[model samples]
Target: MPHPTGPRVRLRAGTRLRTTLALVLLAATLTVGAVGVVGVVATTSTAAEAPRTWVVDAVDDTSGNRWDSVDTGTSVVTIRVGDTVEWQFDRATQGHDLVSLAPSQPWETVWPTALQEYRDAGGPSVTYTFDQPGTYRYECSLHGPLMTGTIVVVPADSTNQPPTADPVVEPLTGPAPLVVHATANASDPDGDEVVVAWELGTGGAPTYTDHTMVEYTTPGTYVVRLRVSDSRGGLHVEEFPVTVTGTGGPGTDPPTDGALPAIDALAAPAQGTAPLAVAFSTQVTTRGEVHPYSVGLDDYPSIAGEAVLVRSRGRTHTTLSVTGTKPSARHGSVHVHEQACDDELGGAHFRLDTTQPFAEPNEIWPLFTSDASGASGLVEVTKAVRAGPQAVSVVVHDPDNAARRIGCADLAPGTADLTYSWAFGDGTTATGADPDHTYATPGTYTATVTVAHASGEHAGHATVSDAVTVVVGAAATSTPSPTPVPVVDGTPPRISRVGPVRTVRTSRPVVTARVRDAASVVSKKAIVIRVDGRRATKVRWDRARGIVRWRPAKALAPGRHVVRLVATDAAGNRAARRWRFVVRLR
Candidate 1:
């Protein structure tokens, strides 16, 4: 369903990187194609050392002091030629892709040389062999810097193997003041001794040790790093993420305590009204602390505004009254999600079908723009009364990059009494109990309304909708498309001549052809005659009957000679004829 004239939200994931899949298939060794199942640990080929397989898991948590979107564990992996590197996709909660990058090149130089990879959870295992020995850089095509790493491939030999590092932490998540014991099980494949050092990742100097205990005093997130260095100057780093919860202190809820100061239902349509009109209104504030997973710290400036959502029936006839999210007039995506502000990307878009296709008609999208002040906004939507929990929070996306979420607001429940949606029939729509629209063209249209009670007598109840016939009496006109030009078939003059096979008694031979066209008249200037592959100097022509005669410039000394005639008409069409005569010396 498309609305040619209706207001629609631009739901852009902002990751247009999927289009580069073609480039990935062309230059990549293993990418998306012929889907199948492979072992969790598989080798491309076997030779001397059985080609050990390195498992690089998908790390998608923001427990680290710094948020790196979806990363392939181990910032750097050292491998030998012919060995396999397997990228696991089971842990990627959100869509993540692996793409090769040109490390020396700048950001603008992406795609043509970038490796393209697409693998969803439970799809398949992605792996590639390093047939060539060198350093190769790769990163997530969508997340870029936030999810990047390096791969070092050397000649396969009894080289000093880099120590493999994996951190074992007691608890990954728990309450505040939690004491955590961590150990790095590291060993070199070449049986070489390695040294280990631990850094709290939050800040401070590295502590030299094999295992240590750290005390967590606040509720937040932390990451501990363990770098194991081999005596051969080869080192690899591994990170361990930990979550620290507070006892309802400042560390737990720093930004407004995840609450909206004011919430109101601006509409109240009576029960039994099929098409109900309602608007859920509330105040939203953008706090950097609210959304931590954002790529940048200051993606959204601090601002506040009242957000209102108006909804009608089946198709969301949505109207967002809350505007002025920023200092200037610009648009961004605002979607109603099912979870709280705690989940990544607000869990997911609150959808009704919860299946294959997901977009506009399937989900509720509220749009907002900065009126003048550079701050907050909200969206309006239409759903059943039971949609209260599903429509918990509103997520605002960056105006320039829709994938980077800038702000999130948890909507207080039971705020709106009735919601409304209206279809003006001319492919246009309106939301809110009282909506006004102006039609430009004169035509009969079927206007419709869908309404639902949000709270009170019908909390989490069903919805009703009604339609009515509408007619506009004004006159309108339209111009038809222009016709194409026709071709002049068989209009060019034809060169016709009749000749008998004869041995020329004389050295010079003459040839002639006539030019005639029933559709058009032919002119003498349009006729050309040639003798022996050269233009005939002594030529005879008849204008009235359209005839031409041509002879060689000199006496014919060859065994055979050819004479040609061509005639052309005003329609840019031409015709030609050729004849040959034999010249013999007596």
Candidate 2:
């Protein structure tokens, strides 16, 4: 009984007090230890969680925007205790891009587009990694001189994992059919390759898979979503709105024939005469714009009967001055000649009737019309004459427009040859039937012969005249015994046919003679027959034939001509005798 009261009360009270004190001490100690651990971790992690961040200058859609305006600008960032970061440009136009100025950097870019386009718009960038805590410098690759930025990281806590950053969405804007290409610079502190997938055009517009490039063949505005995944399985998604515009490149070619095909100008004048100074010229339908062309002249037969040569002009338009003296006129059908054209062959043909005056044969003996049919020109001379047995050919016009032998004649010196036979002036012809007639006197006469061809009697007729002088002299004057007219024993000079019986161009006439003597034979000399009214020559006896023949030196014009002989012998002996004879001049 004594213990029950004492044990119960004392025991219960003492147990409660000790239990309270022990509980308080234990709580205080645990609180103090936890505080110390947290402080130490905060200090260590704060020092470690300071992320190495590079400030990349960034621009926005409006006019332009930059990450910082100062050398050291601020950007709030959170990363793991030991993570590296490289900040660079994310958007651009006309040659803008991103770069990190610091050495040992990681990310860099030019205006990231198609590789080909990128190469064309050159820009290279820089990169860096964060091992310890510090702010880093970065800028736009294109506008680095104007851009500056920085980044800051805080300490890690119970919730130490950093929030996944959205993938950078840069909607490329340009002319369409829209084509876009991009490069992923996503990196992980865990050292892993980045994988990027794209879901294009939200709102049922279009969708794309994991390709790096996307094309919108159609025209429209679209919201593009890009999902980027890192090696650590961290994923970031971003949406970009793009507008596709449409246009194209430039057009070239000329018009077709329908638009009034150009009419090229000619190179030479339309009408030009030969032996004339002709200037060549032409005009085209189109405006003065120049084109290649050639020129020519049709030279078949010139109007002036001349030869012409075409020449080349250095320019499209040229002054062509030519002398048409050597070319021939168009005598027959239209003779077409081609002068020049753009090409060498088959140019336009033209006809020039170079109709010059016909050639006159009398003026120019052998009137040569180049268009003559003969192989060669006709030959011409004065006129021919023949003596004894002879054949004569007379010249006249032929069908070939040439002078040629047309008539022929044959004659003998007998009564049949007294009058010269005319071989009519043309070949294939014979005329003047009054042929072969002896002249009463010996003299020269022009025997004219006119010849004609088959063309016409007078059309192709030719005239030929010859100077015919005849030899008619009185017979040698025969001196008689001088009637024994006593004279000195000296021989006297005698006249012989009175100086060869000079004859006149007339009928048979009388003749007289005179002789000179050493012993005054002139007084004893008697008058011999006056042959052709002139003194006759004296002829002495010839011992060989016992006869004396009279001969005249020169000839006279033929007609009814005659001659007589009278002579004085030696010893003053004179005798006069007259002989009649007819001389023919053929």
Number of the predicted model whose lDDT against the real structure is largest: 1
**What lDDT does the true structure give each of the candidates?**
0.48, 0.27
> How would you encode candidate 2's per-residue C-alpha lDDT over 1-586 as one tens digit per residue?
0110000101111111000000000000000111122111111334423433333334433333344211223222223333433333343322323333342212111211111101012223223332233323334322222233333222223222212322333445665566776443444444555555555652243322344567765433444544444543243333344555442111111222222211111112212222222121111111111111111122211111111111112121111111111223211111111211111111111111111111111111212222222111111212121111111111112222111111111110111111122431112222332232222332322233322222222333332222112223233346653454653555544443232133322121222233333233332234344446875465333321112323332333454444454445544455454444443321
User: Ten residues in a row with the worst lDDT in model 2?
Assistant: 18-27
Q: Give the TM-score of candidate 1.
A: 0.33
Listed in order, each prediction's TM-score against the native is 0.33, 0.16
Residue 57's lDDT within candidate 1 is 61
lDDT of 1 by residue, 235-339 (tens): 555555565654221111212322222211222211112232322221111111123235423644432222323232222223233322346655445676655
